[model samples]
Target: MPKAYSYLRFSTPEQAEGDSYRRQMAAALDWCKRKGVELDDKLRFHDLGKSGYTGANFTEGALGRFVDAVQAGEIERGSYLLIESWDRFSRQNAMTSTARLFDLATAGITVVTVDDGQEYSQERLTGPDVSPMLLLVVKLSQAHLESARKSNNVGKAWADKRERARAGEHKLTKRAPEWLSLEDGRFIERADRVEIVRRVFRETIDGYGRRTIVHRLNEEGIPNFRAGENRKRKPTGWHASSVAKILTNRAVIGDFFPGTGSTRFRTYQKEAEPIRGYYPAILDEDTYWRAQAVIASRRRVTDDDGRVVQRGAAGRRGSGVSHLLTGLGRCSICHGPMHIINKGPLPRGGLYFECDTARRRAGCDNMNRWRVDEIERRLLKHLTYIDADAILRGEASHGEFEKVESVKARLADAEKRRKNRAAMLEAVEDMDPDSLARYRELVADVTALKAELAGAEKALAQTAADPGLKARLAEAVDLNRAMGEAEGEERTAIRVRLAEQLRQLVEMVDFHPELSIIAHLKPRADVPADQVPFTYDSGNWRLELSSDSEPHGIDPDIFPEEDPDAVRAANAFFLKRRLAKAGGAS
Candidate 1:
């Protein structure tokens, strides 16, 4: 009897856990019985709900790990890799799929097609008058060809749907928000769910961030929106990213952009005209646009080099969003945002932060790290002690708009440069010796400049269009009272809610000499610099940044010297922060 193993994959969880899985298993067992092969149950690999079209199916999926085991000489040389059919192995085209089949053959493993009792071994695959490629072309089952062709055709269909959406001639036929339900093929907002949405929007506009909003909703025991049902899964919990999505959705403003993918996806457009009367809007235009601007501004942090810092991709997978302050730190010297570092899944799963520029060796010498857990605790403690009156009101400095004007000024500069380059190109002759090289450089420069200009213009437009949202956003936020009102775990949950409120009121924290943490109060973008009364400008910033550090600083009790690394990081950290007025700020 020969040794055998089985490989199984299903594209959807329903199929993986349903009759498809059972039928595939029966076929493999019957094949083993017929061939008198001893099937090793432990060697069976299951790529549950993993697609086979991508090479990842064999390279990085569970099947890939089996390949790794084979390479490690765990499986016997003549072991059989049993599967239902060719399509079950991979949905790739015949050429690529055959090549992967040949790889296993070369490794001395025989691939057995259980459905037909066909065995593919090294000798049978490579014989006289038989080029493996040509043989596969002639012999690949029609089922495999159809599967591959269908994948391509469906992609093209999605392309067609997207184009139709862009033309505003099509609307998504899939699931709408829970607040919206399809009644008689028209979208109608449920009054109950609409109230929930309104409360979410109001809290968001009035200084509540995503995580806090999620917590507030969960604490209220509200049911989250679900697209479908799954018996094996846990009940849906409101997620910060989900709340963030609701806040930023243009559909709330009566505008919708239908997007295409395997699943019907929706894209958000900042300046698109609303699809009039197609669906009732849950939020007025001003509030919708205002929510968008705030969300965009929070993600628009730039390093000293003027490159945007990317936030995590929707938190850590199934873990949902972490606390708000997780990625908000900066290295005062390198001027790049800090990124979280982890100790993997080893003995102690410790998480910390380090300067990105230094980590990448991009030339700044600010090597420092901070324990994330400790930092989160300190922030909570800091919020506990802060006075509510410190959050100054009555100024137009709703933090969303301050960052916009600076970006606009930069955009204006970009536009001017683009025009200058265009003019120079107009004067140059194509036949000239330096013309081609200059043209190429000018074209690339203009392209980059235009892209930057387009982004800045869009952001400025979003901010410009919404005075009403800003008014609502500028409503007095009392972080102290909000924190004080919480009784148990809710009090500690201030990490995100207070962080969101602080974003608009407080500009950023600058760590200064003697471990002093300076709170820079943001000024209104509309407030003129000459009238604002400040000696030094924080780089073209017009409004005065009142530092509140002398009163409310990082609590001394929370500070600790964990190790030599901590000491070194602390020293470098402060040295960078205490640099001269001309010194860089991350």
Candidate 2:
């Protein structure tokens, strides 16, 4: 009696949940009973939740492992391998699996499929009988063509749905649960969880840091969703990353892009593309932007050792240092980072900045550095001068601040338009296909409009609150002048003001006795000189020009005294001579 191993597979979730597997198993067992084949109970393999539509080159879960075992001669010769049909065992594009099956037939295994009523004998398998091969080839070709057609249909449907969404005529396939609902149709927010979400966003945007927010939330008895209800095996508490994700999610801002078909259908298993959202926003656009800007500024902050100061970590200690210069500084010589360095004790250390490239790379002659205090002083002077002049010229009037209000109004308008489009799309979800297509076209138009609106709003907001631009034309010019002149606590206030405006420009500062000081400036298009004030002297040679001396030609034999290499050699020779004299004296 030949031993038989039954293999079964289903392509989709619907098929798995249906009678597909049972039907395949019953047919295979009936064939085994008629053929007088004794099947091994242990070797019966069934792959549920696995797709046969995947090409032959890809492995089919447990089926792949079983095949590997058979190829390794784990099963005795003349064993029967029974499956429901070629399609159930493999798909059309899987040429490799078909070839492997042929090889199994040659190895004295009887390959049989109950659905097709076909049997592969050793003589037919070894002799290359073209009929079975042709049958498989044709079936596979059909499968491949069918698969392509299905894919095209799905893509078209999704495209049409996206269009309808844009036109205010389509409804989302999966509605938000009772806890959630469409706000104007673009954002996903829970009425019950709105306060929690808002708090999370607020903490993150206000620079409280994600981890701190998580801790605060936990401390307030606001447990993890599962834990709050006192459920057994409660989920872990909220994390910083989760808070950060919420802060950045466009879903909160009332946008929905249709996920790509490959993800929607399990065909390619690739990442989905995010389409323009056609839904109501939970958070206002300005609020979303505020969070983003804060996040960006936080990312740019670094500690005295030049390492990034991550969120939830203790912020860098300083009298006044902004978080907007974290990773932007570069060495003038080697184009490496110019990090912050403190020369004294903790908290009160005199801070200086220098380029890491000059310290590491050989032959990098540039030595850039600057004292933090001195740099800040100069920056303040320049800012104060600019501010005072603007005030005197009446440039720092109420008119400038009115732009902020104008931008706020524009933001509100764009948001209103977005919501209206979302509502329109939701109203026509059950329309006819032709009407749906037209609706989708309209949705696409709205999508484009919303995108433009978003861009305009963002630009306007940036311009309104631009510290750099606003500083050069401040409405509080007199106050700025007074603050600039103020000392101690007053100076600290001015420092904060200047810090907010100039934080993005100054990245870091490093100081060394040999290299002096270096300052790393931001790569703004307007600011040309990124390297800060510093002096360089490499023991024997200094990069200083003699203002009073004239250049003269010297003979190579009569070397210049200040030549670094020559000086080193002379010192070495003198040291050796002194050693000889000491030996004689001894």
Candidate 3:
């Protein structure tokens, strides 16, 4: 005749899996059937693994949800709430329990305590002053006390367990860190996971960023640290944030903060002191801290929203500026990084690559800025002057076909020298009247000659087989085309690509007063960028353009003087640098 909603609750997972849930459900169902009340399964609400002592059930529990709906008039005023007992409705404090019951009764809905066989309604609860429901209040009060007692017992048991852990009886709880295995009341490093942690830290120290490491790990299909292996679940993958956590975790260093402290049940450990020697360390303290230092160093200065703002030229490549030479340009005098600054009405190649030192008030006499279009145009003309395309074509054929023979000849000569030296070294020894020092020197020379011969032979073999020349020639041809033929976005993309390529090719470009460019050639091979010996050898060439004596201070596009020889030298430098990078130049 009446609509009755069933409320099912399980305080613990064990209870959910046990007969308690079935018994509670059966009681509610049987009571409804006896009363001939229609009970729809849709109206059955379940809140499992929730504690009765906490009022979180009201906010998060199914019974509390039904009560909430009844109070909010979502349920009809005459609907019934069927619970196993008053205690099942709530095990809150005496006052709170009584207040909630009164509120429920006042809302004109009936609360059926099936186990206790008690029914509370608005009419029965009506009294002039207090709505004298002595029996219900007493029952609720008993339930509240029982909940408090059980909560204290649970807290005591937790304290006992933590004390046992503190007294070296067992680990703090059931499980330890994933990298650690709890064996016989002690934590030992899990070998496989330990290796994973070591790799993470090592990768971090090697300058691989967290996100990059994550991508690499995912690419390699390396599974992450997961507990439920052998259980039927999807495999978890690595993430940047998770990698970051692994990097920052101190537990990998074999120190574990057990988090055993003075607090209530399930509370945060306040004064945590890590217990060292709990497990074998995956990484030493020095390596761990070194990684931490680098990680700290890379953390950029961020705005309120965590977006990095460029303060100085520390790590800023000036991605905001779309100019081709923004990152590659360098101040000739001060050696500070050059940033792109747009001046004039703009788009007439008005973009200026100026030194950041002068702008930052780090007073420098060379406050000169180079124009983008002027530099690009000069650069192109310089490439044409050197006939770089022809040099590339010639170099390609010579490296592939011609140079191998010469390298072989040199290699043969070196091997002959090595053999002669080795023979001399063998003949000498202690038996000869010559000094031991002389014999040792001969041995060293033979060793050197042998190494040199090997290098020459390798070089000859590489020259004969290397296929890198075509790509280098193609890149150079593309640069020439972008400078001479292309326009608009196509030209811009090529220019930017060329700029990036040149960045890897040339070390830094130094601007002179007359729009003259001097790119202090950065080495392209194993040669270091700074110590690019000032040489005219095509293999390790440096660029130096002639400058007008005084500053012209006119438009950058306007050439101070048409020096064809200077242009050829500069273009040769560019082509040589590119070839050096391509590993096709001898």
Residues 1-586, model 1: lDDT tens digits = 3489999888777888899999999999898888788889776698864567665568778778878888899887899998887777877766777887888899999998888777888998887746654645555545466866887798678657655655556655666766788776577888877887888876655445677678778877888776345657766779977887777665665655443334411222221122344456877755654555556546655589967554321233111224445435566675566677776654466776677888899996766565565554444333321223223331233334534543444344345545654565578666444334545655565576567546655664565444333222112224433544766555544434444545544444443223333334455443332222122334332122123321122223333433333433433343243443224543
Q: Which stretches of candidate 1 lie over 4 Å from their true place?
A: 129-135, 141-144, 163-170, 210-242, 255-280, 284-286, 292-525, 535-586
Rank order (by TM-score, best first): 1, 2, 3
lDDT of 3: 0.58
The prediction achieving the highest lDDT against the true structure is 3
Task: Residues 1-586, candidate 3: write the lDDT tens digits.
Answer: 3488887777667787889988988888888889888776766687775556677668666767878788677777777888888777788877887778778777777888889667788787775545348777788789889988977887778667655654556566646777887777667777888888888876554445567577667877778876458868866688777887888777777665554323333434622234455556777765676566445434435599954432121233322224444345666677666777778766654778777888888876666766776675544433221223323232223332223333333344345545554565578655544224434554565566567546655665555333333233334444465456867645544443344334324445676554456655443232223223332422234455334311111123332234434433443455466556547533
What TM-score does each of the candidates earn?
0.55, 0.54, 0.50
The lDDT for every candidate, in the order shown, is 0.57, 0.53, 0.58
Number of backbone collisions per candidate, in order?
Answer: 2, 32, 0
